[model samples]
Target: MFGSFITMLTGIRILKNINKSLLGIIKYEKPIDKGIEIAGYDYDSVQDIFYSNMNAWQRNMGYSRLYDEASAPFGMIVDCEPIYFKYNNRIWLIELWKGQYDLNTGCEVGVYTAEKPILNLPEVYKYMFYNCASDEDRLTISLSLKKNGKTLFALDDKHWWLAGFKLGEYSEPSELVMYLNITLKDEEMCSSFVEAIKKIGYEENKEFIVNGNTVGLTFDKPHTTQPITRTEQTDKIIQMKNKLLCDKYNDITRVYSNLTDKINAIQKQAPEIYSEIVDKAVLRKYLRSMKNTETE
Candidate 1:
């Protein structure tokens, strides 16, 4: 009974509304030349996507989860080479550089991180996701270094996540496990949610996630030219209709505002003309009265 109680107190508990975004898991190394293929993922699986993210993040500044918006392909962030954004605030998040390679080895090196870009991104993401001030989740990693025959590469870890996480698929693994406890608030917010999924289990070499409840990308990552639910075309039509309506509304509003501004400017710049128009109308009324008396 005592042991059971302790296990309840100490067991792994994931947070409520456990978003994949708030959790970032990186698996990296001295990069496999972008030529070495990962069995489960893609060629760009380990490289091309970071460039995509850098481009998107540059344009949007950040995304809004409240609107179900994410930078379209989120997994690409994983392909980034391990780098620390230069600033302390940016340190928490990972970056994808446009360039890398060792000058000494001529191994086609990867890109290095720029200082300012690094500084802004971490804070930008932290602000966007880690909104509350409560104690954040942190991971402690344990990895062992090995060599494969004559090849001087780190073994057991096929890859790593960020500067903090290391994972290997073909090679042996230096395992990583996280230690976290649910806060009182986290527990309160998710009691029923917790009850529904208490039976959920974690598997070994099974591609576990940084967030406790979710599963890692094991053998079955999907690829599609479009969304999974194609039958929702009708619903999507409705949504499109709504969006067009909103856009039209916004356009009309902008036109109205611009016209109002022009009118205000005309009034301000030509007050004399406005007064003359009003005065002429009054003078015409007097002339009509005089003409009526003469005709009578």
Candidate 2:
């Protein structure tokens, strides 16, 4: 019975993982590099020269962190900046690389002109990225998760720079992006898509109806502020108990002062629910605070 319950929990987590991946880009056997003036040069020779340098780096243990998951195996290449430098002779090389991948695959995609992850991730509940451990620059990750606005789990660990996620079968073409999979729990992860949704600039406290062309949506909100967290629920019940006890004692903790004493006073009092509730509340509060700081 115990093992079965654990297995079911594991399966539920896997379902979430599978569903989230549906939002990422997918391709294979394709180096995402494009638009370079290896100009007037044979493609074969350029590829060979690239490999020669790559082989030397591999021999020097430079790519040792190739399989690192902290290395954002998936992300989007958002920029391409040009640069020129001179050593023995005048030479031009793209100095910035900017791309995105599934942080677990260690693949570089998008349009990186030789740049890497420039932002820190304090809350990584829903994404993976390049994490590195180098004698020089280090890779680090600090992110948290909040599902349905409730803290779930967290960690603050240093990782090496990463590249991409492992290639899986493509479900759709590049045109139909899986809409940035953000769970109700991922309050922050869906920001990009959310902004896109807002860009339509058509809020309808009243409907903006188009006779035969425009679409429709309503923006009436139907919820209250600060919905009860699990801890809040637990806190409410405890507050009730404390108030009842205080009133009975004419304002003294004396009523439950011997609560633990009573626990031992009885043969088996089912392990005082009040103590269990309070302990849980305290631990959860601490953990939630930690997770919140991780993103900040």
Candidate 3:
């Protein structure tokens, strides 16, 4: 019976590993460069290059403030100054439009001069998430799960720099917004997504009406009006210490229970060879210690 129980637990552990492998793989890849740094490019030169290479589509229709000009596809919308930069002598422009993507009225797009191929879709995302911190400089990193059950890395068409400074009543600090579409197919992906967000201390606001399958998210840097204190650190240390103690206690309890069952069986068969090494006093002592720790 003991051997069978061990085999069952081992099988369960294997199944969990298999499940994790079946889910989509997420990779964080870094950028490449020569001796020169590409990130700290001059702003005016980048903007001028981007303006010189604008396609007729963007030039004729793309106004600076479409929302305020009363030509916005969406209702009154927030605005942020477009970002431009040059990397490896290539000019790039990032524009946020009131109606950029097909589904969402607002979207952000990064354009380049196309003299040489710029970073692919995935590389663009890695640069945003791993390299950049400014809202104006980063793209929304999202996971797309379509109705057909295909999962892929997705980016929001609209990127708002600080969600457009002082737009309406949103007075929060600078932050980034990401969107996930058609998320119903995979439970593991959704669970991991939420846990990953929590691990980074990002708050989720669910007031947008994107659709049942779609999820909109934003993450801001942690803030506190109060000054930092030693008491806060002490509290965190205490909480972690208690958690470690509790985990150890639970593991010990499980082993003790299994051993006790075996001891009882052996005692019934041959009391001379097998006897109770543990008594009520020992158990009581352990329980009292745990209680004392909790009180402390």
For each candidate, what TM-score against the reference? Answer: 0.17, 0.16, 0.19
- The digit string of per-residue lDDT tens for model 2 on 136-237 reads 322123322222333222223332221112111111111111101111112232232233234434333342222222222222221111111213344345
lDDT of each: 0.22, 0.22, 0.26
Distance from true position, residue 115, model 1, in Å? 27
**222-244, model 3: which lDDT tens digit per residue?**
22211111134543453343344
Alpha-carbon runs more than 4 Å astray in model 2: 1-125, 128-271, 289-296
Candidate number with the higher TM-score (2 or 3): 3
Once fitted onto the true fold, the runs of candidate 3 whose alpha carbons sit more than 4 angstroms away are 1-76, 97-106, 112-176, 179-296
Q: In model 3, which residue pairs have backbone atoms overlapping below 3 Å?
A: 99-105, 107-157, 107-158, 108-157, 108-158
Model 1: which ten-residue window has the lowest total lDDT?
Answer: 99-108
